[model samples]
Target: YINDVCRTLREEMKRAGIHAEVHAWQKHLASISRKLEYVPRQSNENPLSQLHDLVSFRILVDTDNECYLALGHIHALWRPKDGRIKDFIATPKLNGYQSLHTTVFCLHDCLAEIQIRTHDMQRTATYGIASFWYLKDRMGKEGSPNSWKLSYKEMVTWIEQLRQWQQELPESADEFVEAFKGDVFQDQIFVFTPKGEVKDLPRGSTPLDMAYRIHTDLGDHCAGARIITNMDESGCLVTRQVPLDYELKGGEIVALLTNPAVHPTRDWLHFARTNAARNKIRRYLKTYERESQQADASAPVPGCQTTTMTIHAQDRPGLFRDLTAIFADGGINIGSVSSTVQERSRAIISLSFHLPPSLKETLRALLHQIQALHEIEHVALEPHDDTF
Candidate 1:
């Protein structure tokens, strides 16, 4: 079985343009006895530690995007068995290992497991146990102790959860083991932020999972979800509504809106299949629950304040960052900001920040900086009232 499997794998590797070599070891008891006066033939047999018929294939790629492209090529070439595609790059393994895996039938009804990962991912997987040792060897320096603290914390949490599960359901150890294997190692979904940051989530993630992916605060405060893509007459995406919960495919973008009044429910925990999403919801609920218990904790009564400034510049990178940095440096908090991009390659940024006592001078200096950028056609300030 091993020889046949190895031969099929080698063929596949060549077809996929990967370079690899396989080696097998064997020993004969008769040969060993004849070679020496005292010959010992030892065979280590441990059923629990027995090696499985898993074949790991490493593929090198130029970039993260190329990694997904390789996955597509491999899947298209092989018929993956149902529920056999696992993408850890999107969700990653518990120890922060990332890869793409699939099981397929190769040569005469024989099933083979294939693991795909980039060169860097392979190094991380092999040396992650002695991560600090590798890092010191590479950089000739030691990193801060705090670098490993998060890993330690995650380990402790896993241990505590395991103990709790054992205590709560002592008779279901086998069931727990099976479920743990299924849950702890699984494929990931790739979702996007409104600004296009990729978020790798566990399979079966919802828009709520997306919200938490942005930030815990955003997730807890998520009131509702809005799928940003257009729908057809049947309401299914000509491109599909990025599936919520099931394994998320690569190249899906999502956005989330939040309201402070929203709170998570126990049902959310049930529906939230990912540990990250569930833990975030629980944390948010606990925090808000405590806040509610301590004080009035009512949503801040809606109120409004307003100011207006005219921005004159060609839209450029870091323009918003630069403008906001000025206000932030001056300790002027923004109430709102809006901008209009014109066809003539000009833009007007209108900002509504807390009115400072020295408003005129601040406005003048900001306008001067904007004008100094050499892109401003003109600048103006308008009087505005505190009404939303």
Candidate 2:
């Protein structure tokens, strides 16, 4: 059954114009035993029949880019089993292994696992970093002439980096092993930027994580992600803004839309996957809170109450006219007004209004009115007493 599946898969690849070498194999008993140890005891199933990779086909391609191109073709050819596809090529194993794996129900109800990788990756999977020494040991090259030896040494350095992560993580041996299986060995999702650059994130990462991975500034200003996905019934591509809590998946192209007035929300900490992303968000929040406190302390004068209202909204010709008219109708005197038009047809307006003792209670209602206006996205009011 495995052989027939491989043959059909190779034929499909040929039809789809994917050039690669495909090798099929059945797992040895010893290898199967080692794998069974990792399986949860709760699964009361036979390890042999349940193991998807027991009967597998490995396809070697030429480049990393071609791996994804081939993956699209393969999915178009076969109906993948639910939750059976894994993309290790984007997020390589801690041991520096990379591949694209998928299990599908092929002919005769046989479940076959297919592993796709580059030729270099296949060598790494076989002998790991020692694969380079294999050529040198046979060819007697001592003059640093073998490029494979140099590449293998580089792989060793990366493996050492993985060891550093293991040391830094606070986990027992069993826990660490489980984490390794989950974070490194499990399937990964790959998202693409507007420029087509691939970002390998954990399976449930949000768009905010992608922004932080790109740059701290971009992440700090990230408003949302415009994701292009195949959601239409006619198989057409649709673009929409992904909610901050949305979990991203593989092969989705995301274009980040940034707004200067937008900042990280507290709930983002719950969804950020990477440590860098979480740290960046925390730092931004801390700095913002500190600045707000300082401004509250120093912005007010003696015997007077002052408040600042920062408004973010869509840019319109009569926006200022409408805002000032509201202030005039409310009998509030604006001390000063500053506004800046930004990219993406947005504007940031900051207003300092003097709060007389009589009108102190109406300040909150005035801010609420501004927030309820059309085109307004956000409104923040800060008031301080100068009686100190």
Candidate 3:
């Protein structure tokens, strides 16, 4: 039945002067078994009846526009099954599969599935993102024109997005398997950045997840979300605050607001859905709390007249030169310097300075200045234990 549909489709496309290669296949038994796990147990129902793509036909073309053109011609020839059409080319799958799928009744009233995609898309569908290598091999062997080459730029972008998804995936075997099925294999929702770039995220992802996907620092400093509703008649954007726990929907443009003075809190972990966002929040909170504890332990006690400032950074030529200059500008004289640069370009420097009672209030501003210096990773101030 599907073979006849494929023949008819090829003949119709040929008549229309649309060049395409059509292929047909049945679903593998292993794939059917894996799908059976999800289907509910029915006493009288045949398991095969539940599968939609028992026999499928694929149409391959040369360009994205040709995919739609093929789809339109296929629809014109066959009466499509109501509500059985899906445009995966416009919105690709989570794994970057791009094809237009439709199930139609054809050839003695048997249902058959048809997929339309470009030649490059067919290669990607067959080989996943590794199709670039396959296409390259073909180009090398056949000396194909540059136009025949599959663009690696889109493949690279998908690889980056997959990497971000992997970071947030579950670690344990059972949890990882479940997350793979639920997150990676399922249909995804699309959201937009402020610049109108589309981002595919798992369903139920929140604003914090979007921020973390963009950058760790952005997630750490995320204060709120601005949901772009639409443009006003005056051409200004109308936006509303989307709460931290709000589930994002498709096509909504989200703008993440960041506050430099704010650091991530442990409470953020509870609301964060993605592993990437939660892990980053926890890491930042751990570092922040540790630094706070260190500061408390190093606070100046009564009768302490000296202070020690610890600086950590990546070592470079003349990196510490600016530190001495900053001290001179602040009118603080360094009494002692203990410093070391590790093999991996990591530097730790401890500087001791005499602190008078009158200058105690001004010390915080000086410490802030040191922290803001380029190449400095961390700055912590403590009372010098040894009396000067």
Write model 2 residue lDDT over 1-388, tens digit each, in one string: 7667778777877886888888888899999999989876656766667688888888888777778777767766654554466666555567777788877656765677888987767887888847645765655555554445544544565455357446634435654465455545444677777776777766777888778767789888888788987573344567998876677866678988889998887888887875546666776798999998866544544556777888999998888998888888787777788989899989999998766676765665677778888899998777543331
Model 1 residue pairs with clashes: 204-245, 204-246, 205-245, 237-240
Worst-scoring 10-residue span by lDDT in model 1? 47-56
Winner by TM-score = 2
Over 4 Å off, model 1: 1-57, 62-65, 72-82, 88-98, 103-114, 120-198, 202-206, 221-266, 274-276, 282-388
Each model's Cα RMSD = 20.4, 14.6, 13.7
Q: Rank by TM-score, descending?
A: 2, 3, 1
Error of 3 at 366 (Å): 32
TM-score of predicted structure 1 = 0.36
lDDT of each: 0.56, 0.72, 0.72
User: How many backbone overlaps does candidate 1 show?
Assistant: 4
Question: How does model 3 score by TM-score?
Answer: 0.46
lDDT of 3 by residue, 1-388 (tens): 6666878988988987889999998899898889888887789998777677888898888776677667667755665664466656544666777777777667776778888888777777878767757777778798966545444544455455555456655354544345445555545565667775656666678888888877887887788798964343232446889777787765467888888986777777777876556666766787888888766544554654777889999887876898888878876677789999888889999998777676665676677777888788987778543222
User: Which portions of model 3 show Cα errors greater than 4 Å?
Assistant: 1-96, 99-118, 126-136, 145-150, 153-187, 229-238, 299-388
Candidate 1 Cα deviation (angstroms), residue 338 = 40
